[model samples]
Target chain A: MRDQNRQFRLAKRPEGKPDHDTFDLVETDVPDPGPGEALVRTRYLSVDPYMRGRMSAGESYADPWEVGDPLRGGVVGEVVESNGAGFEAGDIVTGDLQWADYATAPGTALRAVDPDLGPVSTALGVLGMPGRTAYFGVREVAEPGPSDTFVVTGAAGAVGSVAGQIASLAGARVVGFAGSAEKVAFLEDELGFDAGIDYSATDDYGAALDEAAPDGVDAYFDNVGGPITDAVFDRLNVDARVAVCGQISLYNATERPTGPRKLPGLVSKRARVEGFLVGDFAPRFEAATERLAEWVASGDLQYRETVTEGLESAPDAFLGLFEGENVGKQLVRVSEPDE
Target chain B: MRDQNRQFRLAKRPEGKPDHDTFDLVETDVPDPGPGEALVRTRYLSVDPYMRGRMSAGESYADPWEVGDPLRGGVVGEVVESNGAGFEAGDIVTGDLQWADYATAPGTALRAVDPDLGPVSTALGVLGMPGRTAYFGVREVAEPGPSDTFVVTGAAGAVGSVAGQIASLAGARVVGFAGSAEKVAFLEDELGFDAGIDYSATDDYGAALDEAAPDGVDAYFDNVGGPITDAVFDRLNVDARVAVCGQISLYNATERPTGPRKLPGLVSKRARVEGFLVGDFAPRFEAATERLAEWVASGDLQYRETVTEGLESAPDAFLGLFEGENVGKQLVRVSEPDE
Candidate 1:
């Protein structure tokens, strides 16, 4: 009960790729819960591409992470102590529990993580925030249908991987963009992408996209919006929709860099490109989580977790998302099996 | 039996700005109508900006004009004779008729022009296709409400003038961009535009747009897709919708020119910029035209026509749209107008 809590605090902002100096592992006391609060022992800490934006001192669509503060993200954990009436001890939960060994919330931040559906770790991947993101970005923005050819960028990662499968399930002809031949093959062979284009292999990305989507693309799920996006813009059908979920490729630039050839393609194609935050649809969380769990259980939806063991390994796992290291959902498994 | 026919033909294609050499007028014998055809005496002719695209050789969104051929456009006229059973002589009609004093068309193409709607020539401008184009571009594409701040480019031309007014009527605070001070004032004074920006005045177009629309633009009705539009693009609000109705500024452009440097702003703001041709909404013409007529009759809408008298002057009227010569709708009163 008196185990020391190890916390990774931000040391300095990274210029491009984060180094070990950017993070500090410090020992902190496990504090008691006050009125209407609960202490949580994190089971899994989710590492996402969006976390890269928070590291910058510059303006982001979301708030920037302050230096010297603990890095925070969505985590699936167990509540060890509670003063809130509804959520008691031993309940599995998911919320914005920071990158420390344990966290305390006002019970308002944490939600019950359903264990029967699949794994509790899925709360950080398919059946939680990322799932809600895929839903809103696809259903609300892209609105892919059976006749539509849906194209997804960053198709091997947490959100993009889920978005591609969901579009396919909605009867769309889905094509994915991944970094390597292996990931491209994985997307097509295992994940059921209609086609896959390895962006890292080709200089003529436009032609590669053309080959993959022989028919014109109706909607584009743009997780990476640079040249990959400009190429996709050129291939868009009339009245296309682009859901801009992230721009990971540009997030860590040391300076404001020049981007790919764009605009004329955007206007000529008559497309709609919109940016969104998952928090915009927070009201629909319960309904979305329920449906996401059902799909995962029925095997209609697929999810995978790239788990890094131990709380001390959390920083490297997060930095790995920027380098495209993880295969699917990246999470740090914080604690060993409970007796 | 002896009413001779005459047609003004497109003798040569214009390089940049079309000149008088591009046209050739001649008298020819009238051809007899076959089954499903009727003889239409051209009374009023339409000379629109889009007609410029038709004059080119190839690779346009619209069909090109044939060499040494009598040009055809939206015409309001009288049915002189008919091989088709549906029409009778002296029935006033409007349709795609040749740029001539006398022309023939399928009876199906001819709609009996309502003479009682103010002046019959109104059929060529505010009461017809041009009017419907403004309607759909503003309502369906921009969809600006009272709370919206609307910005328009080429804001004193046929479609642009109507678009600004419609946006104002929708309770939007309207700002217009015009080539001259006179046209700018006209948009502000007569059309109820809150402000008018003379784009020719300075290089600070984005600043000018910002000055005109302090709250930032909610909807942009873009007819000119060059720098003027780029200026408007720089001032869009979050989730803003831009209806790219026409790209007249780029029509005769020798090379693809770029400026108005604020595209990436669209991503963060989640704005939508899309190109549209009025032909895409041809199916809804009847509904759109009827509403436009009612709006015009009730004085809720206003129209202006830069009429060039006689069929011989149609070329000058057509070329004037590009030079910013016309204040609003440009038309050629091809005959006595059947008065």
Candidate 2:
């Protein structure tokens, strides 16, 4: 075990879009844990769209990662050492353990990462927050009724891919929008989506959406909010429900993207659009994750992990989210499990 | 009675927006009704923004007015003679009377107009359908919880003007938006409103909206759907309810208006925007109207009527709705009450 920790901290606050200069990788002596805290050897790290929001200094869902402070998100690791806490050495646990080789945290935040349900690393993907997000949005927000059509953007992504499958399981007709032909094919062919549209080559999203969803949309689970979302608004059926989960497309934009008007549509159609943060449902999270884990075990839910091999590549993995490089959930392996 | 009935019919379907040439007025002999029908002598006529959509030869909430046929809408009149049906002579009623001197309607479509309810002319304005629209929207659609702030646009117009008063009676902080200073003052001084904004003088709507509704909007009753509507969206607090009743702002535009880009906000804010048609509430329309009439009689709900005297002036009265001419409700006086 190393006596030092390698940390990646926010070097400076990003004004608009972030680049390489915003992060600073630093090495420091590993500190001893206080009572009730355990030192964990991180093996996997979670990178998500929400972390980008935390990089800015202001009010956000997650506390902003201040300049010179180590960045933290969902991490799965075995406890190397503990200060008389419930966690023991060799016990695998998960929590927000930062972008570091080793992290010390209170025992309360840690959850036992059960490997038999699926790969332990999946605690950051299918069996974790992203999976729970898809569950809450599908079951709580949209709640697709009989023979309803569910439209999802970023259909081949972590939250979206899971959302489509769950929506289908709930007896809804599932359609997805993706940026590439390959993703569109993957979503439709491999994932059991009723329909998929390649938004990359489609210039007129309104017409393409019309062709894809001829009957009009009943519920929209939006991951990318821009013109594509506006196009969906134009074709929304009366009394439709919209779950605004993420705006990955607009997160990095220098200014707010301007698109076709929506207030009239909101009034004329009497449809509903709502935003949600997954963490709000954290109290009932285990209930969602347990079902997701069971679904994956029963083959009712399938997930693809876009894995980056090493902890050193975590920055690249984080940046890839904005570029849409991830097919499903994106995670980085900090260390190999003892075989 | 004259044998010839003067009728205003659709001359041509408007491809974009309506013009003078789109409507044609003609003279024809009044047609006699068959069984279960009553011949209605048109006395008062309704000219509203919703009629513009009925003029188009396409699918909408209401059926389109066919070319060479008499245009039809809500008409208040007396039953001169009943064709072996329920209606009797001197029976004041409201029904789908065409834009002509006399109309033949099935007994199912007609309702006896109560002469004791203020002015029978008010059946065409406040204390009537528009008033009912306000009552139901505030009580049902935009159900403002206590401490909720209700914001309305096109605040001086019929539906919105009434909505503000009803919201205030329901113990909501009412803020309104209108085109002119005089109208804004009327909303604040004469009508019961917490705040009023003159949209014409305010160059930056977002800032002005933020100023007026600094605490944030909890409910929005939208009558106009343009830039002003967009501004309301940005100022909405989390979990806000938006009742989109009408979009008079876009009624005359040749193309769809370009304004606020809101799907992103919808996603981030978790708000619900729903569209509704008053006709859909048929199961409870009488219940709503009864309560509204009671409120008006109690002097709890006040109203204004922009009466354009004579059926020949009905076209100009309707056109006046888009121009913000009607203070409360715009109607045409087809006959003198004593006549």
Candidate 3:
């Protein structure tokens, strides 16, 4: 066992885009598991866009991470030691944990990861929170019917990719907006999306949509909000549904960004725009996970990952999301799991 | 009966706010009723905000009124003659009719006005399109619960006044934004709204909302969208719902207006913003109108109207909606009902 554990702490709140100064890495003694707790050795650290909200002092769905406190996020780890907890040593688990090499968590908070389903790192990605988010968002919020045009922004990212594929599987014509030609190819070629637009390559998204989504957008899963959203609002068909999953583009803004008023357009279309959080569907998570696992195993739903080498790369990995650097799930490999 | 009917025709599409130049008063012979048609003498003509959309060449929910075509709107009138139609002569009815002293429409298009319900003018006011808009918007869309802070803009206008009253009746604590101190009193004293803010009297709407909706807004019904909507978006609580019924404030803008992007705030609040047209609920409008009539008959729902004297005043009555000159449903009393 390692004698010391390394953890990342919030150094300060970011004004706009976070920089290296926003995080502080510190070495500490390996945490001991308390009664009904297990010491976990983190193998893969998930660097998600939602974590950006925690870096700010403002109110959000998730509580803000205070400065000087250990940063926390989704982690796939192996149980190092169990102190009267249900799990045994060497068991793979996933839960919300500290951004550290070793940390302690209550047994009830952790779920065992099945390696046979896929790579255990998927416990932090495809078969996890992002997958559930996409599952519910497509089926429940933005319910794209057969022959409906489903348009998704940030289409090559973990959640957006999954969301687009899910909508396609539901028999909807899927159109995606990704950052690059390569990512757009992945969406159209690999994921069976009907069409893919490299949003970064075009200035007029409305014109692109005119060619790609000629029927107009019936169901929209928005991850990157800004000009893309404005363009989507313009093309919304009557009775259209928009699921607001994330606004990664506006997350780092120092001041509130303004755009053409959308509510007026909504009245003409009778469209519905709703924002949702995955945690709100906790009771249905297990069933959603099973369905997602089946899709992953059947090769029906494909995914990708941009894994950085060490825990030190976590902040850079996270910041890459806002820059559209990562193709899919962004993760930091802290250490290898014991056989 | 008048042999010559004076009708208002669209002269040309207005650049911004329509004026006398937008309408050309012309005299025409009263048309004879055809098969399944009835000739009706217009009594009260409804001058609504939505008409502005029809005046433009741009696409909207309603078809644009072409230049040189007679302007049409909701009108309550006394049937002069029937040709194989359901109504008898002198029977009061309401339907979309031209801005003339007399017009002919198919029997299927006209609904008999039960004079015993209230004043016949109400067929175009409280018991008409605006009232039904408020009904579905409040009961189905906004859906305020007991103790919920329900905020509404244009609270003294046609749809908004009824919306606040209905929400208040549903047990929500209602806060209203009106244009004048008298309108504020009308909302608070006569209508039973918990609080009312004279929006024209205050430069800071956020501060006004802070005082009126101290618990934060749970449900919002927006009628006059613009800066007031921006302020309401700022004070939304978790799980808020915004029903976009109208954007009268933006109807006159020559250019598409821009405001703070609201989708990001929606994510944190897990909120919903939906825009709707009353016509979308056509299948259920009868039931809704019946319920609204019951509320009115029971004195649970109170309504007021600002009536202009003649057909010549129709254009002025509609232009007044943009200026916030009318306290309630603005209408033009073309003539009195036949004895």
Give candidate 1's root-mean-square deviation (CA, Å). Answer: 3.4
Task: Give per-residue CA lDDT, model 1, range A1-339, as digits (tens).
Answer: 547787888899998988788888889898677788889888899988777777888656567888999888888888889986258788998889779888788788778876887788888888878888998889988989999999998898889888999999899999999998888887998789999998888878899878889897998898776778767877788788888888877777676545433344454456676777788788988888888788887878877778998888888898888777777788899975482
lDDT of 3 by residue, A12-111 (tens): 9999999899999999999899999999999999999999999998888899999999999999999999998899999999999999999999999999
TM-score of chain A of each: 0.96, 0.97, 0.99
DockQ of each: 0.28, 0.52, 0.90
If the candidates were sorted by their TM-score against the true structure, best first, what order would they fall in? 3, 2, 1
- TM-score of each predicted structure versus truth: 0.89, 0.94, 0.99
- What tens-digit string does per-residue lDDT give for candidate 1 at B1-339? 336777889889888777889889888988777899898877789988777877888445557888898898999888878997389998889998899888888898888877777688788778787777788889988989999999888889888888888888899998888998998889878888899998788879888877888898899988877766666766677789888777787778666544433334555667776666677788988887788888888988888988889888888888888889998888888667334
Tens-digit lDDT track of model 3 for B79-120? 999997899998999999999999999999999999998999
Off by over 4 Å in 2: A57-60, A84-86, A206-211, B13-19, B57-59
Count of clashes, each model: 0, 9, 0
The better candidate by lDDT, 1 or 3, is 3
Query: Total clashes, candidate 3?
Result: 0
| Candidate 2 residue lDDT tens string, B30-122 | 878878888888888988788888887655567777788788878998887788769898898887779888888887888888889877877
lDDT of each: 0.81, 0.83, 0.94
Report the lDDT tens digits of candidate 2 across residue range A54-152. 897754556788799998889999988888769889999999887988889999989988888888988988899899999998888877776788999
Off by over 4 Å in 3: none
